[model samples]
Target chain A: MSRKFNFCAGPAALPEAVLKQARDEMLDWQGKGLSVMEMSHRSDEFVSIANKAEADLRDLLKIPANYKVLFMQGGASSQFAMVPLNLGGKGGTANYINTGIWGKKAIQEAERYMPVHLAGSSAEVNGLSRVPRQFEIQTSTDAAYLHYTSNETIGGLEFDYLPTSDVPLVCDMSSDILSVPTDINQFGLIYAGAQKNIGPAGLTLVIVRDDLLDQAKAEIPTMFSYKVCAENASMYNTPPTFALYLSGLVFDWLKNDVGGLEKMADINQRKAAKLYAAIDANDFYSNPVALENRSIMNVPFRLADASLDKLFLAKADDAGLLNLAGHRSVGGMRASIYNAVPEAAVDALIEFMNDFAKTRG
Target chain B: MSRKFNFCAGPAALPEAVLKQARDEMLDWQGKGLSVMEMSHRSDEFVSIANKAEADLRDLLKIPANYKVLFMQGGASSQFAMVPLNLGGKGGTANYINTGIWGKKAIQEAERYMPVHLAGSSAEVNGLSRVPRQFEIQTSTDAAYLHYTSNETIGGLEFDYLPTSDVPLVCDMSSDILSVPTDINQFGLIYAGAQKNIGPAGLTLVIVRDDLLDQAKAEIPTMFSYKVCAENASMYNTPPTFALYLSGLVFDWLKNDVGGLEKMADINQRKAAKLYAAIDANDFYSNPVALENRSIMNVPFRLADASLDKLFLAKADDAGLLNLAGHRSVGGMRASIYNAVPEAAVDALIEFMNDFAKTRG
Candidate 1:
């Protein structure tokens, strides 16, 4: 049976094939008579699973040897605290580019550990655009790192290009990590919470450069220290075993079933374009973000007739298009077309939007 | 088909019924056509699932209305840092009773936040016994809280009674929670990583008194703040949904199949007694912990002739007894009899031990 298209901002849809494979393996994982959740993290069986998952993820992203991939817990929110706690050595200053809600959160968290300088901000533009080209980035020679949210799930804003700076770049790719291809070597660190495009909610994937690993403050707890996690293979403690298992399945699915990141990028772009075209086709609906900076994974749009917002949602829900409601901050509708969201689902959503627009217009 | 009796220490065993229910619900949950993993955490459907799980937990534990139960991410290791970050307000000192590896780690983490006084320790005794009665606990009037490890999985040690102090008692009950009955009111705070007796690895359960809520440092991330997690109903961010669902099933199984905590406690006592007796009856096997303070959940025993240890483990693995290897720090065997470990499994292990001991002797 076909599944309804889910446009949840996060804890979002996973590939049906991946889910089916997981379901089939839920009872007995490779004839081990144990679900992956029940196995000891240190056991040979789990070690191989964890190792293969990391290897496959490395291959999918083409991560550099200098970057260590750590599977952690507590999501990106935890990393909001951890990034500064570790990277802000000696409580120095750092650069923050605020594009939206996630960037603001990252800055708020970094403030506790160091002086966070606002390098660039789009919030002044009413949270609908990217970092302005003319905004000056005041980079101190001693600044620990320059941090930004690559894609804002709530604001539906994304950075079209990385800011050019001498300082190390750290990006929170929580909402849009593997949806498209990018230069992995440019950033000192990149962290993504896996609930959106990856697999499950509990696991956070961190890719950190080797040089930054040992820069954590001595006062930081071992669990939060990037060096400790990297050294121990993110098993400094019992990780979210099931989440990691699902993430491994997702990585494998991306490599084999989805035809790797290049294909996924193309498919995701098509999905976003189809939905965005429906919004731009008539004055009845509008997407405020600039075309060049619009997110390929999340498309936030609104009806011209404000009174029709609730009606549109009700009709969409009735038609089995769920969680299309936008963030309250944005006050519109958002369709998060992540890797797991099939092209057909996006086509269906576009059809529904067009049909709804005809009556509303 | 009947399942094998698994004796893994953690990420250990879960109720077969719970696993079966999870398997059955893997594809479509209650006709939702979405697996629990695929459900948005913020969706009304998943919200209800999370709420019911919390309510069931509170009901099973008979937690007071004044206490808040938080289903958090990051295992107990994260709690080691978070407890200090939240409770160790304004550089206040706290007392930590070091019983085993977990306690030592907690102390190390807490020391980063404030001056942690070592109220008592069992490490000098090789982590075999609980905190010594002769040890004096120096509680400062300004201390934040007193901490202890209720049960140490690595070293088969457990507290026999509560420490006599007016300070708020905090216990890391990671290994022993839900295996027996206890007074929930006695603890000002209790946190357990869910891999052992609760449900899965990703979720950590924290029970804290309401009065302790406002004591956290304001600088801590909102996600790590016990106050924020409680206020948001543990929905501050996307939680481990599938983990929470499985945990709810385990809670139900605990209520019905295991005859609740009271009955489980009695059965656990009997099971521990039977196994300990077998080890003590024959000098070929020995448990180092003082008999009165030994853990009923984790029984770490060693052969009198150490040369036969490898042989014993090899034979045990062939017989489907896995993860019986002792922690590297403590060179022996550990049989973790969690809630899911049936008495029959303990009997089988004892039978195997006897058969092996005869030949070694």
Candidate 2:
């Protein structure tokens, strides 16, 4: 069956190869006579699946040995609360760089746990069009850590360069983790909800430096504590076994098909440019994000005539481009061309956008 | 392909119909051109799926209007912390009934939040055989609530009758929730992790009484707050969407195939009785739990000779009676015949047990 070009922001498009692989193995994983979904987490088969997923992910990004890759849940949102609870030690404050809604969410949740230093925020810049420039970043003295969102899925903005910090720099890379290359050593911790670049919605990937594990609060809930997660290798409880198995398939696809994150970023850059170029060709479509900080993973735009937005979406859906409706917070069109979205899909979207503008304009 | 009898404790077996449906719809759900895994949670398609799942569950259980059903994560283990953080009203002690490992875990986590009254515990009765009788319960004058595990997975103990409490009664029905029918109005709250009888791992089902939500502390994390979850209709952030979808399919299976909880419970009862009878009929096998407390979900038993336990499990697995190993905490064997396990599987297990015991004894 022909598949549509799905541009969902999250719980988003997975590689066709990965999806097909998962489907083929759904009833009985490699003749084990049970779906990975039904496999016991403690079973040798699932344990190996979990291990390979982590190892392959580690290899994909050249993650350092000191960083423990954890498969967790509650997504990056939960980490917003967990970071402060785990890292916000006694008599210490954590600095937050608020780039967009995700960053603000982390900062707000952190406030409930510790002294939050809203060191820098893009709100002052208006419309959240761009990330805070290097010189604009401000942090407090003796801050426990600095937290920021690497990619804002909603605002369609992202940091081009990793922010420098004397203290540990933690990143919420939920939307763009494997879409681009990253140096694991630069950040003390990084977390991503496994929906966009990864496989499914239930799994969350956390890469935490070993040194920070000991700083977790004594009273933090066992499930939320990085110390416990690291100690148990994220198997403290029954994990999302099926999702983890699918994620390993995604990693395998990334490694064997796309080569690696460096090549992945190059392909992603090309895909984003194709959509941006089509938008730039006509004033009928307008993007609010700054050219310098626009997200390659999520490209949100607006129709020249607000009334035509529904028509555009309907036409797009009819033409097989899906979930292109932007976040309700940001009205108009949002084409989330995540890693799994082939360049062919973007080409199809670009063609549709040009035709859409011509008809509406 | 014929499926094996998967006896995993959690992340356990799923209904064959549900698995087949998921497999068929893995690539495209209802011709939406995107798998449920890929559909945006906020989209109309996914929302309908989530809403219908809750509605079906409510219909099956007869949950009152005063209850809010929340699809959450971090499993039932996270609920241990959330119960105290949300229901442990400020300065008030909560009564806890310690039945087994799960109950003790809840009590331990609750201790970190508020003073806990060990209202009753079965520790004095060695091997966690039976729950304390009605006369055994003791609650503090100012206790916030009473928490108990409806079924102990490890020890194979289940409460035949719901415990009465003056204060709110919070039950972790993780292993036994949808397997049996219950009057929802009797309990202030009920929660269950999905892996056992619901669907895949990672999704957690939470039934919170509307009034009990207000008791949550101001300082509780937003993700963990019943107020936030209820207010947002379980979409405060991106939930485990695929898990939620699978759970809906499971609810459908329970309704359409199994008829309802009453019939499901009856079937489960028969399956448990058959296995228990097989054990009791021979001197080669023994179950530690009292007959009244024997769990229909998890049937744990020991071999007459402990040395033969490994051989028993090996031969059982060889015969496709898979994952029959007991919890590490409790040795011997545990055949967790959750709702998904058919009567035929239990019959197969009982038949295998008799033949193996005859040969060994």
Candidate whose DockQ is highest: 2
Clashing pairs in 2: none
lDDT of 2: 0.89
Q: Which candidate should be chosen as best, given TM-score against the real structure?
A: 2
Give the per-residue Cα lDDT of candidate 1 at A291: 72
Tell me how many clashing residue pairs each candidate has. 0, 0
Tens digit per residue, CA lDDT, model 1, B132-218? 563466677777899999888988888888776687889999999988877899999999999999998999999999999887875
Q: Please state the error at residue A205 of candidate 2 in Å.
A: 1.2
* Model 2 spans > 4 angstroms off: A123-128, B123-128
TM-score of chain B of 2: 0.98
Residue-wise C-alpha lDDT for candidate 1, range A124-182, written one tens digit per residue? 45645656553465666677888888888887788788776787899999999999887
Q: List the RMSD of every prediction in angstroms.
A: 2.2, 1.5
lDDT of 2 by residue, B1-361 (tens): 5589999998999998888889899999998788999988899999999999999999999999999999999999899999988987555898999999999999988888889899887643555478888888999999899999999999999998888989999999999989889899999999999999999999999998999888877667788988899999999989998899899999999998999999998999999998999999999988988788999999998898999888898899899999999998868899999999999999999999999988986
Per-residue CA lDDT of model 2 for A181-285, tens digit only, reads 898999999989999999899888999999998887766888999889889989998898888998999999999999998899999999999888888888998
